[model samples]
Target: MSPRPDTAARQQPSPSSPPSDRVRRFTRAERWVHRTTAALMGVCVATAACLYLPEFAELVGRRDLVVRLHEWAGLLLPLPLLAGLASRALRADLGRLNRFGPHDGTWLREALRGRRGPAGKFNAGQKIYASWLAGATLVMLGTGLVMWFTHLTPLMWRTSATFVHDWLALTLGVVLAGHIGMALRDPESRTGLRTGTVDRAWAEREHELWRP
Candidate 1:
């Protein structure tokens, strides 16, 4: 049977025209939660630097003010995420972050080779980071609280908490730097995060498993 020209033409996209389909990647609530968490995280990092580095301490001047800011920022680190739990979609996404799938293993291997494979809304690397950060945030908060309430914690525990908090802060700073570096290099990811939407072709290519 001979196919009609019109039928064949409609079956495939035109080569000359760019795909116009766009998909929503992040909801308004999701964007707001991410931005709020980011701002608080930045405050925690900056104040920690001010307290730990002599140069930053001199620049910041008021040690008391910096200490208070650091304590509050670290304490509130999980608040945005907690608030986001109201959204069913956000809660579902959190579950996805906590689980590892077969495709995620393949994605990790491809990622090492500087290639991308099919992934859901969040890839293996992102899931790993999110999972780690969730636990790390709790650890930091617990240690920070122990240090803050010295009256409640024994001298030995306080000393141990202080050491843990200091070292964890440094580790988090390095991981965050790498996260920011990757974000800066990936324009489509950046655009999707900012605009809450991504080009259909890009989404289909990079996140074929993602469904919205």
Candidate 2:
């Protein structure tokens, strides 16, 4: 016997699957800013190598072009972050980077003891990296400008800027190497950067305090 229309409709099995258990980790604009910043930094590093290292200089050739590229890339390094301010997500994350909680201190101690601790969106290490890099980049920009525009500063000031710029570039290279190594070791972090989302389970596990 056929049931009434309302009864049949109620008895029909659900068709769609459950929603995905993923949380947004990075917004599209945030990812774009990161990618653009990395690319410009890479250009600066590569061109710096060409200008400073004899082997790379010989291999690449065209001294004038390399210098121009390096200078322009360095000059444009901050544009991506400035443009990304249009994104609310990016603005919120920047605030997270600036704040250090009591939990961050606990997280660091537990990390030293080979244990995991609850962490918010930006952990202690990440916060330190972000803050340090921001200051370093500004210093680099200031020193680089002085070096480029010879008439902008006195001879003594230019010499000091050159000294600081060279050493800072080398230090930045080492820090970047460590950062890349750590990122490569964590596939989940790479996935977050790539897809702008992370598994809810992974977030709850790794960032117990940050499950959204």
The TM-score leader among the candidates is 2
Off by over 4 Å in 2: 1-19
lDDT of 2: 0.91
> In candidate 2, which residue pairs get closer than 3 Å at backbone N, Cα or C atoms, i.e. clash?
none
What TM-score does candidate 2 reach? 0.90
What is candidate 2's lDDT per residue for 96-150, written digit by digit as tens?
Answer: 8999999999989998998987699978889999999999999999999999999
Task: Give the runs in model 1 whose Cα sits over 4 Å from its true position.
Answer: 1-20
Candidate 1 all-Cα RMSD: 6.4
C-alpha positional error of residue 160 in candidate 2 after TM-score superposition, expressed in Å: 0.5
lDDT by residue (tens digit), candidate 1, 147-208: 99999989999999989999999999999999999999889998877878889888888888
Task: Please report how far candidate 1 places residue 128 from its true position, in Å.
Answer: 0.3
In candidate 1, how many Å is residue 18 off? Answer: 16
Each model's C-alpha lDDT?
Answer: 0.89, 0.91
Whole-structure CA lDDT of model 1 = 0.89
